[model samples]
Target: MADGSNGKPGQGLLGDTENHARVRTTALVIIAFAVVLFMLVQARFLLISLAVAIILFALTSDVIRFIARQRIGRFGVPNWLASIAALVLISTALLVLSSILLAQLNTVLVTTVSYAERAPSAVASLFGWMGEDVETAVFNSLRSVEISGYVRTVAGQAGNLMQGTVLVILFVGFLFAERIWFDTKMTNFFEDEGQAARATKIITSIIHRVNYYLLVKTVVSVITGAMIYVVAQVFGIELALALGILTFILNYIPNIGSIVATGMVALVGYVETGDAQTTGILFLITGAIQFINGNVIDPWMMGRALRLSSFGIIMSLAFWGAVWGIPGMFLSVPIMVMLLVVCSHVPELRKVAVLLSREGLPEDEQELDRLAEEIENRKG
Candidate 1:
């Protein structure tokens, strides 16, 4: 029998309580996210190994499947045998590549350390025509960075690389062993066959996109590395082989990699030649090669397969780079691809996928646009 005005206060009190609870929940979520991020950073080695293994699996799983389906004398190869053969081949190639890289890195490190003393003088000489004050300032600035620190950092990275390779190999082996069970596990985990099928489709899509990206990257990187090697040899640059291998490896990391490689080539050129002309020519050549490969060939091959926002890519690069260093940078794009694909499938997380996507259009919006286009065409 109370008037409606008396009920307004009760409603307001309930709304306030709900608002407070919502804020508390958001705060807890933020705190939990921060804790998880910290944990990931601390456990980066294991996480990175697992990530690399997954990528390798994605890259080769299809080939393994195709191999398993092949018949020899009317008998198909066993899936397990094919997987084991693939694993052994990949492992052996990895070992050979790793040994070569380690040897090259060792030589480069030694050469770089030796160049430290000469670098400042080389720079000062390049600016010898300038005022004494300018030359002195430049020399001091260049020499301020300790070469030993660089050496130690490189050595630490090398050690970590060795450890990570072992871990990655082990992870890859186990993942291959479990590959057969993956589908059964998915089916068992999802009570609904439709849901399980959808999940499997999403995973397959992810694998296809990631594998295509890696394949394109590999081709572009090799081309760029070979061109740089040719230039280095033609210009008589010291440590040409090392520089080539370094270029190949660095090309895997986006944006920053090309810039760093170009700059490093120039610096090494200047130090070795003790001339500005050689350095300038080397820089120009490296820049051109990087430009053609990164800006031209890479995009042409990748096409629209990776609908990743540029800003999102940068954010992922920085976040993972901070969390896991160089290896994280290498894996950032693949990780982002997984996130974008998974989030796109989740109703609650579709917004995140949209935010991460280059086009900023969800599937529903895309369908609507398509329908609109069709209607317009019919009207015309």
Candidate 2:
């Protein structure tokens, strides 16, 4: 009888362990399937709109809170009212800027088409003078392509811009509403009060980090854009302001953005007057601005915010681009930032977050300052 009791308890313990393992395996399998299903559906446009809305809400919430605190005219503005006002102002500015850029883009496209038409002849003449087989090959390649197809493709993409704009607005409205209820709703999800408080802290930390990242990035992008515009004007490139705005928008993408902007500027230079010398100068100026911003200013401002490795960023870009196209690429870094923030809080995931970070932890101002000074001295 005693032996039977001992055997029964041991069997019970073994059964519990087996059950736990089965549960973990099942949960993992479900999560994997869900991820696969989401990718297969490719609902990227909707996801992008939601992501943009959340980012806009995070960035603007502080301004809204500040306005509410002012107590103007002896009556404080409500949080929602302040949020709406901020949203309206930001939306109006973006709309006006978008319209202007669209007009400029049309002009640039027409100019590009005209240049492409003459490219074959220009290349052939240069090749004839050089008597190089390579030149002949280049001329033949350029001549074989139909430029109209490219023009049509650009035109088709332009049509989609309006739809994307509308979606962004709708998403922004929903995100603002969600911000108001997020804390309360999240707290209610947990049974324990302590758990609720910890969840709130985690969520708040994530929001703060994301907001700071967006603010710094926006400032950096604007500076980069303004510099590009100024350089274009100095170089006498046509549509300098328009090109500057384009540069600002594209610079939101990490790693590959500067290359795209430089190529665009070179194309503008080539199209405006078909002068190779002018094109070369435009490319050089654009590259210089990118070099300064990407190497010096961006790293200083970012200060290990996302902490993503260069290889991680490139991999994320490729993966997201494959899954969601252009919208995916734009969202890739932000998603990575969110993951890093969450991972940093979890014991098992902290190692991954450390690998992603620049120094494997939050920024220490003194250390960063010392590094910056060293870099400056080296340059000098």
| Best candidate, TM-score | 1
- Model 2 superposed RMSD (Cα): 7.5
Candidate 1 lDDT over residue span 288-375, tens digit each: 9999899998999998878889899999999989988999999999999889878887889999999999999644435434444553
lDDT tens digits, residue span 252-274, model 2: 78878879988888776665656
Off by over 4 Å in 1: 1-7, 127-130, 362-380
Candidate 2 residue 209 Cα shift, in angstroms, is 2.7
Can you tell me which runs of candidate 2 are displaced by over 4 Å? 1-41, 120-131, 362-380
Q: Model 2 lDDT vs. the true structure? A: 0.74
Q: Look at candidate 2 and give me any clashing residue pairs.
A: 307-356
- Alpha-carbon shift of residue 175 in model 1 (angstroms): 1.1
